[model samples]
Target: MTVSGAARGMLRTEVDRSLKTFLDHQRAVGGGPDVVPLFDAAEDFLAGGKRLRPAFCYWGWKAGGGGDDPAVFTAAASLELLQASALVHDDLMDNSDLRRGMPAAHRRFQALHEKEGWNGSAEQFGAGAAVLLGNLLLLWSSEMWRTCGLPAEALAAAQPAHDHMRTELMCGQYLDLLEQAHGENTFESALRVALYKSGRYSVERPLRLGLTLATRGAPPWTDALCSDYGTGVGIAFQLRDDVLGVFGDPSQTGKPAGDDLREGKRTMLIARTLAAAPPEAAAVVRRLLGDPALGAEGVATLRTIIQESGALAACEEMIKQYLHDALEALERAPITTEARTALADLAVAATTRDT
Candidate 1:
């Protein structure tokens, strides 16, 4: 395997181990047959991500000259829990049925309600349970970070960045919903959602958290790296994810084909397509974009419109440009040579990976 691939694999292993160990310990507080499902749902949701957020955090620490301490890994792995919280809420909001080929938390709960022949509305029960589960994961993420065994000084230094990240993510979620409600899929609005919801939360904040923890303080250059490099790479990563939601194979992505279309996601790709598509094609998009029953033919038709409109190519070019910008920023970052190389590799992988 390539060096980058090996590094990612090993990092994934360590992050998974840390998270599993934390969850296992938390089982006591949640020790009951009834609460088993919540923990099970958390585990299933966290099981299969690429661990990119934690990677960014880990590399950020390395950039600040931190060594391989298990405590750092423990702290970094908390990103997974935070990310899982976001995904659970996201799936619920989108009414998505699947995640990584498993029933979404809401759907899982829904099925459980039906199986037990509950008295009230199964759908409502499912939605409530999913919300509670998402909140629980969020709580656990903070707990994990606070208790990751890092020095008090280091933790205090990183706490603001950590708190701000979650707050930003939550506010971004609101912006997303607002955009959907207002039908505000303009390029600028979409970019705003991209920045707050995915970009900063995914890479920039995590990197800052790492750097602060490693140095026991946030260096001025850390802001430079987070802005120029982390934000650029993070936006590219979200853009790539937007493409995969439509064009990627369901087997690889764990979501159904054109799932984003069904959700009516106002992604930059969709925005670009609207800008570039012929009137007739744009009309077709408007007609079919959000129909819950969008079938294979609809997906194929939308795909063709996206391709013919040149939006797919446009988005791809944007990814390339953003990646270039991120690399240029990394070139200027005053970090170890090893960290620079790893961050560069992470930028590529974050933007290009299918899953």
Candidate 2:
């Protein structure tokens, strides 16, 4: 493989190893049979991902002229645990059955309850277990970050980004849940939710944290440029994800087709379709959007509405526009040539991915 490719592969291996080691230690030292499922769920769910957050963190550091250090890898890898915590809770909130082609953490726990002939409601037991498991992952992520052995200055500089990432993610999730409850389906609100929910955490904060570590403190201009680049790219990533949610190939996406529709996701695509569609079409879409029993026919109907209403095209254009803006931000940033090039590539990968 090429040098950059090989380096990325090595980084993935190290990140996976670090996470596994941490989880393994926690599992070994923790409770009994009851806790095993929690640990098992985490390990299994964490086993697969694009490793986007870690890569962003690593490359952000490199862009700021940091070297390839193992300690940095450990710090970056910890973001995966935070991501896992988010996914577990998100799945529970959405009542999703599958994640990465496997049963969600709650579902796994629910199955365990059923098989073991445990008392009480299996669903409630599963949900409670999932919540605790998610909390544990969040706790572990914080512990790993705090104990990464970075110098005091670097840790302090990076801590705000870490704090903001978690806080914003939680707030975004709350807003999402609230939006669904109130049935507030506006294009502007959908974009706002996407920004806070996925955009900031996925790219901006991780990049900022890495840059903070690399520089020991980020200069104002450096922070601003990374912010612009990361936010633009992150929004594009979320937009692509929204499109994929409704129309993507199930095998590639690792979820059933129309999962988002069934879950009643108030996405930008849905917003746009509602705005652009005829009243009758919009009404039909609204009826089918969140039905738990949304079948293939319902999915196909909504897909048709989205596509025919020009919403999908509009969303695609938005992705391209955001990606263009992200690259432009990169061009304006003062960073290492190699790192800039890699980040540019990452922007494309994040936005254009099928999964």
Candidate 3:
């Protein structure tokens, strides 16, 4: 099988195993009846993601010469749990109604509130419940990590990196929120958000954590290779996401087309469009930026404007550049042939995924 195909298979198997473990844990604990809903919500949230983070961690470990230890699997699963926490909170923050073709966590809670005839505002109830559930997932992720049986020194080495990932993600989120509210965002600022938020957790830190655990001794140049690879691929992933947000089929994406436009995401593509559009067209783009009230027709027009402005081409070029850089970094790193091939495939798949 091809690398992409193999990665997909591995990802599916890991996700299934991890989810079973999660559910079994919940059952063993006999979570309070009131918190049954929370568990249900978490299960639903975990149902349909791509499981990219765990796959990265797994591949990173294998590349670092780690065997198929149960502890590695547990550590990888913890990354997915961390991802769940991030998504739950992100959906609430973005006020997204749908995720992976299902109602978002908050939306699910809102629907239950209405169905149960609860005497409270569904919006408030949903948001509050989702927040608590996200917190629960965060705690669960930490517990998973702690119980993974890694060496004490390895665990200690990873703590600061893990904490930094969370802090940087939160900061990036805040920057994103601030940019949305201000309506005046620069390409540099948007790129910073991408690096700090998605780059570290999505690629760099996870790879580092896995490699650190796998290699009993910390090797020089490991950090540099991870940084080079992570920054490149992480940005490429986000660029692809921006393209999908605007142009992807709603059925495949599991979200409304142009949702990013509606949310006024300060993506590199949008920044390029703003810079390249004709004066009149640029004005229209600026005016519509982050306007939640923009109807479908307006969105269509805006998309057209973006495409015609040459911004799409620019974004595509950037994606290619990042992919090249990632491959170069991989070449420079001293890793096993199988591991290098897997990472290369992942890089291609990440940039080219339709959903």
- The model with the greater TM-score, 2 or 3, is 2
Cα lDDT, model 3, residue 69:
76
Residues 139-192, model 2: lDDT tens digits: 999998888767778889889889989999999999889878876488789888
Clashing pairs in 3: none
Clashes of 2: 0
The digit string of per-residue lDDT tens for model 3 on 1-355 reads 2466765686678656866786678657965787788888887777777777777777888888888776777777788778889888988888888888889899999999999999979999999999998998888888888777777776787777778877887787788788777776688987887777677778777887778778755687677668889779988888898899888898999988888888888888888888898999999988887777878998898899999999999889999999998899989888988888888887888889999
Off by over 4 Å in 3: 1-8
- When summed lDDT is taken over every stretch of 10 residues in candidate 1, the lowest stretch is 1-10
> Cα lDDT of all candidates, in order?
0.91, 0.89, 0.82
Best by the lDDT measure: 1
Kindly report which residue pairs in candidate 1 clash with one another.
none
TM-score of each: 0.97, 0.97, 0.95
**TM-score, cand. 2:** 0.97
lDDT of 1 by residue, 110-144 (tens): 99999999889999999999999999999999999
Ranking by lDDT: 1, 2, 3
TM-score of 3: 0.95
Pairs of residues at least 3 apart in sequence or in different chains that clash in candidate 2: none
